[model samples]
Target: MSEPDPGLSSGAVVAEPETLHAPPPRLSSPLARLALDFCASRPAVAGLAVILVVAVAAIFAPLIVPQNPYDLAQLDIMDGTLPPGSPSYAFGTYWLGTDVQGRDMLSAIVYGLRISLLVGSVSVAFALVIGSAVGLVAAFFGGGLDSLLMRIVDIQLSFPAILVALILLAIFGNGVDKVIIALVIVQWAYYARAVRGSALVERRKEYIDAAVCLGLGTRRVLFGHLLPNCLPPLIVIATVQVAHAVALEATLSFLGVGVPITEPSLGLLIANGFEYMMSGRYWISFFPGVALVVVIVAINLVGDRLRDLLNPRLQR
Candidate 1:
């Protein structure tokens, strides 16, 4: 049989040591694969879905809401404080019920989400930009610069974030911009520490040496290579920080320092409803309270998962 057809023989295939010596099929980078795997996982996917729904509702509040909360013409004082399941104020008409100001609670929550999201997103952005820049510079050029930046971070960390926010808000006076300023000031140190730690490690990598050998500019290496690599941790930090920022904004609003009285945020709604709690209008604060709790919990769940996913050491 032609010498047992060596090429087709099982023994011949098994004896090809070269095949075993050949490198295993190239796998994708660990970071990229990890990110893809996390996104594909059920909990992360569901978290994203919930976030999208909330975002869409907030974005299209005007069109989605039955009554415009801000429009004086549409709001009737008679409709104010109507409990759930009331006639004339049907389930569809005042779904979340109305506030003391006669504003649709559903609409108010939608609009409030817009404000909260905006402030939270902007503050996080501000923190990321400022912190990353400081950390990058400090890590790239150690000594005095690192010491100074780290000292600032340490000093800031020494104080409670709320206390710092309170001091800044007190100085700036209460407004949306001022609230954002306070949040940024209070939040950037966390980002700076995270980025600094990441940058320190990335700066020592062989690729960084290769980039330097290629005569690529320092800014290019720091931003293009180092920064991108640092983003995974930063992203995890940002998600958690956003929840904190939202809660901080609510706390400020509750304390009467966040978004003015003219614009009612969720905290303002809760603060206003506090008085009516004893009057048996439980729906006033209860609904908003529930909404806030749900949002914070959802965000925290997502953030915690992301943190674990990104850190292999944390994996069970």
Candidate 2:
């Protein structure tokens, strides 16, 4: 070997990398930072708190609720439409009052909330997975496939999502699964478009070119390299879509096409109470309506914060 020379000197050492190959900051770091920001914002914090409390209540509905609202054996016609704090409530003491079926309003709301959340979350998750995959494939191999997929998205988007959902539900019939399937059909395009847009941008980056040069297979490049980068806006969209889904479910139920009567969602409750509304037995509809509003508003606030944080263009 020739004289090992770095400026003809032997004592030279390279400085440490810009960042050491330290194991990344704990996964919780970003979440903790997000939590801190969330807490600092009053509306966001309040929204998060509401979501947590509602979720907790929904989880513990069977245990905390005095009676199973769905059990006909537990309901008493005599107790029906009792106002809040009525001493003679047949099913027992109820904090929020009783509906026409003598089902505890609070209990029903909790169960309904559970159903609404379950449907919304599961549908969104399903849509996200499928939509992301389609988006990745379309954008990564952008040619006829991209054109076809985007045109389909365009056609889907041109119609009101609710109308399409209504049509799907008509074919699928009424049930929680049907509702979930309908929402997934209506919502997947949004996720696909968002992912495709993000991936289109990501695929052009130099890292992607380098990844391609490394002979990384399409699957690895699509998921291992590209998917992570496309998730920021997708997460924000998910948060907002959850609220939309809940509202949509309620609307469908209100229109008598969503969840079945035996499992009444918030919308069904509102529909049940519509006649009672004129009769002054307002608690049936009023409390559930309030719950729905609170959930939607809270989720929207949180989603707004997420968008502001994730999208630089949306930042002040």
Candidate 3:
């Protein structure tokens, strides 16, 4: 038995020493907590940093680059094929060299990234909206409607996405809008399939039954309830698909069925430099290719991290 201390005499009030515990970690809001979790992964953090820098550069291309590659007045013919760090007669130094058209590689890449991101993001958003609606309607109705939609999705998915995009582009002709249309056409099926699977699982859950039983409108239950719950996987897919859309667009542009020559994306820039690759002038294609790779890899990294973060089964 523990001996009573002399300081604690009979009839005297004695205070017990409090046990110190680290205060329970304060619960943060979801967004803040998500940010913190994302930051905890080094690769994700690095990828996000790269994406932010590239996005900012692309957004402010005109202000960041020495010259606008699009403006004919800014290009000097004699400056064509200048190596990286070579000084131009009119446009100061060519940091990443020049293409066959005397367009600054750096400027072209920055501008091209802007276009690529715009097309990819817009196409993905469109696909997401279309796909989600289709999936929700299918899952909610089930039976014949679900079978019909799934069959269409299966038929679409059976074909390679790039090949589908190529065919669509060939039919639509070359332009930014056309390329986006092609991409969205090829891409939406994947989202529909994904959303349908998730929605199916969620449809079987108790809350969905409750919502259905409560006489909720189809729009309210599907969009307001089912759609939000299905978003995690859809978000992961969208993030990764942005990279695919950019790559597909680049491929189409490289193949000459993408954006018109008047507007160059990274692929067009690479195609322009293809002839020069044998001539030892590599900066034009090489730099743009590197930029595209960086963008895709960074996006994939972020997507992978998000998948791991959002999927309980994948959590460490």
Residue 263 in candidate 1 has what lDDT?
A: 74
Q: Judged by lDDT, which candidate is best?
A: 3
Cα lDDT tens digits, model 3, 1-316, are 9998888899889665565555667657987888888999999989999999989998998889888899998988888888999987766788898888888888899999998999999999999999989988999899999999999999999999989988898899999999999998988998999899999999999999999899999899999999999999998999999999999999999999999999969999999888888879878789999999999999999999999988979875
Ranking, TM-score, top scorer first: 3, 2, 1
Instruction: List the RMSD of every prediction in angstroms.
Output: 4.8, 9.5, 4.0
lDDT of each: 0.85, 0.89, 0.91
For candidate 2, write residues 1-316 as lDDT tens digits: 7767566465767667967876767546877877776677899989989999989988888887787889988888878898988764454477788888888888899989998888889999998998899899999999999999999999988999889989988898999999999999899999899999999999999999999999999899999999999999999999999999999999999998898998959999889998989888999999999999999999999999888888868666
Predicted structure 2, TM vs. truth: 0.88
Top TM-score model: 3
- Candidate 2 regions exceeding 4 Å error are 1-28, 88-92
Clashing residue pairs in candidate 1 are none
Model 2 local distance difference test score: 0.89
Error of model 3, residue 240, in angstroms? 0.4
Clashes of each: 0, 0, 0
Instruction: For candidate 3, give the lDDT of residue 280.
Output: 91
